[model samples]
Each structure stands twice: as structure tokens, then as C-alpha cells.
Target: MDKLKINIAGLELKNPVMTASGTFGYGKEFSDFMDLSKIGGIFVKGTTLHERQGNPYPRMAETPSGMLNAVGLQNKGVDYFVSNIYPEIKDLDTNVIVNVSGSTIEDYAECAERLVGLDKIPAIELNISCPNVKEGGMAFGTCANSAANVVKAVRKVYPKTLIVKLSPNVTDITQIAKAVEGEGADCLSLINTLLGMAIDINKRKPILSTVTGGLSGACVKPVALRMVWQTYNAVNIPIIGMGGISCWEDAIEFILAGSSAIQIGTYNFIDPAISVKVAEGIKEYLDKHNISHVKDLIGQLSV
Candidate 1:
């Protein structure tokens, strides 16, 4: 048996390590730095139903132990992805998952329906973190009912594995987790960047163009781990934990906390080949502890 292999719904991963969307680009960008097939999967950048210009300049701000990003899910739209990006990444050796985002339920469903015909794409991470313009710009993942509605709509059209990416900005992360699971989400990945901001004391102004952005990196791991553990206990579906995961030890902690898989986000900018290193480190950790398979380590925290 492959010790590191695990299954997320029906999508099989060689290991529990995957590069987070928007961080790893389309996997092709990191091919020269590390073997694309060495890791379990690669979630391409966020794709929307329509093209977006994204936030204005200075949308990114570096923080103390993390960073704030208001990239705004900028992409060339789903149709462009189907026509151009898909062909370029359809043949990679590893699982190529797309991270789908939209401003409305219809947009989410239509975008997901476009990817259904692609043979190489195995799964999609539904990013409910985007603002719902029709609903007064509130994020769909922030409300249980709103989260369920979006997942329910996407589920109707997306027949393959559906992984809902939960937002950390919610009052209760588990509530949203259960809501989506009830609506047919195959898996969950949390806690998407925490709401945060930065200041330029000298200029007496906000750092990011949007004044506030999503906080990520080592600073958010504790919150991510806690949320993952909570959601793991709340829902029966698998959880893909991510936030501040930067190393193998961090990845292992997430697994013990309840993540069947973990994604490396902000840290990817620091080390282009970190995903493969984390995978190797995980295998070594398993060997050292006499753990026969990585699955045995899932939610194995002693509490």
C-alpha cells in the first residue's frame, strides 16, 4: 500500500500536501522549481464566471508574521480557462484542481458547469469567500444559509468532487461547514485568510488599496488549526486544512487536528519547492513514528 496516499471524496491524492490556489498559479509556473507530480495536487488560481480587473494597485501588504492580500480573485474568467489554461495543464502528472469563485449563485453554477467537460480536472474547490454583489456584498461563506445556498446551487451542476472553501471571517466556522456538508459538499478546506488590515504610520494611511485584506502565513495557523479541529468534529466529510501552513511540521499538526489534506499558501512565495519538501517530510515523520500509513494520522491528536 502507498503509505502517503489518501482519498478526498473520489479524488485520490498521492499525499496530503497540495499547493493552495492563487499561491501556486496553474502548477506550470512551479514546474521548473519542483517536480509537479511529486505532490498530491495543485489548485490553480481562482476562476470566475467573468473577467475581473481585481483590486487597485498596492493590493498586497506584508505584515508582521504574515501578509495581507486583497487580490480580489482576479482571473480571465472561466471561459478563457476552458479555452486556454485547461489545455496547458490538462496533462500534468498530478491532480489538477480548479478553485472556482463567483459573485452570485448563478455565476458559481455556470462557472462550475463549464469545467464539467474537462477530462483532466478531477475536482474543484468552491471558493465562497468572494463577495455576493446581489446580497449586499456579504461573503456567501459567512452565513450558514448563504453558504448552503451556494453549495446547493453548485452541487446541482457540478457532478464531480465538490470541495467548499470556508471563510475564516464567519462567526462560527463549523456552522458553515455543516451547512455546506448538508447541501452536498464532498469536502471542506478552511480557514480561508482571516480578515485583517495594516497601516503606514508615516503616511497615515492603510497599506492595502482596499484598507483591509485577507491575512495569511504563520500568524494564522493557530486559528486555522482550531477551526479545522472544530469543523472536523462538526461534520463527517473530510477537511482540507490551510491558512498559515509553511512547513512539514505545520502540515503534520493540521493532519492531527483533522485535516485529511493541507494546502501551502503564502509560504509558497518564500520557497517555490516547499510542497514537495513538505510531502517528503511527512513521509519521513510517518516512518520515524512507525505509522504505517498517513491516513492513520488523521485527527489522531490526543487532545
Candidate 2:
């Protein structure tokens, strides 16, 4: 059989297909819908030190090719996750990753420290670039120094793989990527969500309560591909490319652009089975092209 396995930040995934945080709830929600074992990895919703109610209502709006969300990491917090949710999914078939978020550097470190010894949890994806929160979310991610500070602090406590999620609203994504890599980030996930908004002409006001929300879906694919390519060349660390990925073709595009793995988002709301289809589709394409290993396609793009 062709080897489809790939490693990112020391976490070895059976395949490159993964579910994006916020897009995939705590895994239990989708338990009846699909086989969790078939998935390569599952990045659970963003977890914080405390509970979050998220933004006001009207937090979502549909766009032409994508969707906008200002959910603002509305989760039950890490304490409940460890005490309650973790046990239920400790033995799943895939790599279960926690998408950790925080309002401050201490919050991030404290949360990481909490997950250090969990045998079932192998990694945590630091979501430093969430655009929905008004406070500390993307503030630490847009700049290199601030981003490094957060990673440096958490790196000291978090022993497992550290995946830093990056926001697309920046002057140069590579600078941020290199900065985090320098500070010892284990892996990178890019183009978290471009800041975008829509308006209701009849009401003469914004569609979302936050005025603006994160833009994700096929609309952001081209931009995501470019940033992934740039960051891949900028840092030696492997990248977990995501943003607007909805199909196997889109997944292969990320691999060619230099991502060791890919994440599926937004599309989850449309079809819960999309990720399974993507995983199967990728294998079919590889076999058709005589590619023996998925790694062979990484950065194989030709001009």
C-alpha cells in the first residue's frame, strides 16, 4: 500500500486530512455521523481557561462561496474538557488535538500545563490568531514579538507538539511564521480566517452582531495557498495548512504548496462527511498518478 502517513511537529498522522478546530466540535458530537478512527487527526474546538459565552447572536452570515463566524470560542473551558470530555474520547481512532486559546500569556501557559500529562492527548494547537475576540485573540498573533512571547512561555510547559495557528490579517505572514519557529513552535497552521463582513442593504447595517467576522471557505483558498507556500519556505518547521479547504483537490493543493497536512473547515457545516470523502479521494488521486507516498507531493508544485 502507498504510504500516506505524514508527521507534523512530531505528531504522526495516519494521513494528512484533519478537522479544523471550531469546525469540529469535541468529536463526540460527530460520533454517530462518521468513523472517527478513519480520520487522521481531530483538532477540537478552541479551549480556554474559563468558560466563554461567545459573541452576541447573529454571529454567523453566509457569503457567496464561504461563511463568516464570530462565535468567539464559545466553549465550556479546559477544566470540564479534562474532567468530562477527555475521557469519552481518549480512545478514539485518530490523533485528538486541543485547539488552545487564551486572553493572556498566563492563560495560555496555565492551560498548556493542565494538559501536560494526559496520556490520551498528544498535542495542542495554540490558536493565537482567532479574529473574533475583541481582547487578546489575534492581538498576540498579528505581530512577531508578541506571538513569540506567547509561544516561548507555553513551550516551557507544554511537552507535546505545539501547533501555532496564524491569522491572515498581517503585512507579512512569513515574519510571524519565522518568529514563532524561532521561539520553538512545533508546527504551524495558517490563514486562520481573513477578517471580513457583509451588510444587509435593506436594513442599512451589518449582518453579523460583531460588525465583522472571520471569512473562511473556498473564497480564501488562493490566499491560504500563497501564505502556506511562503511560510513553508520561511521556516524549516512543517506546516498544517488550512483555510477554505473543502475537497481532495484542495487538500492536494496544500500539500503541493508545502503543508505536511491539511485541515477542513466551514464545509463541515455543509456536510459532516466531507472529511471522510476528502481522505478517500486523496488516496484515489495518488494511486492514479503512481505516487507511492503522500510526502512525494509535498512542495512538488512546478512552474
lDDT of 1 by residue, 67-157 (tens): 9999998899999999999989999999999999999999999999999999999899999998899999999999999999999999999
lDDT of 2 by residue, 1-303 (tens): 237887776787888899999988987788788988777899999999999899998999999899999998899999999999999989988999999998888889999899998898999999887432444345788988888989999999988899899988899999999999999898899879988999999999999999999999999999999999999889998889998888899999999999889999889888898888898988999999999999999988886
Q: Give the candidate number with the greatest TM-score.
A: 1
TM-score of each: 0.99, 0.96
TM-score of 2: 0.96
Each candidate's root-mean-square deviation in Å? 0.8, 1.8
Worst 10 residues of 1 by lDDT: 1-10
The runs of at least 3 residues in candidate 2 whose Cα sits more than 4 Å from the true structure, single-residue gaps closed, are 130-138
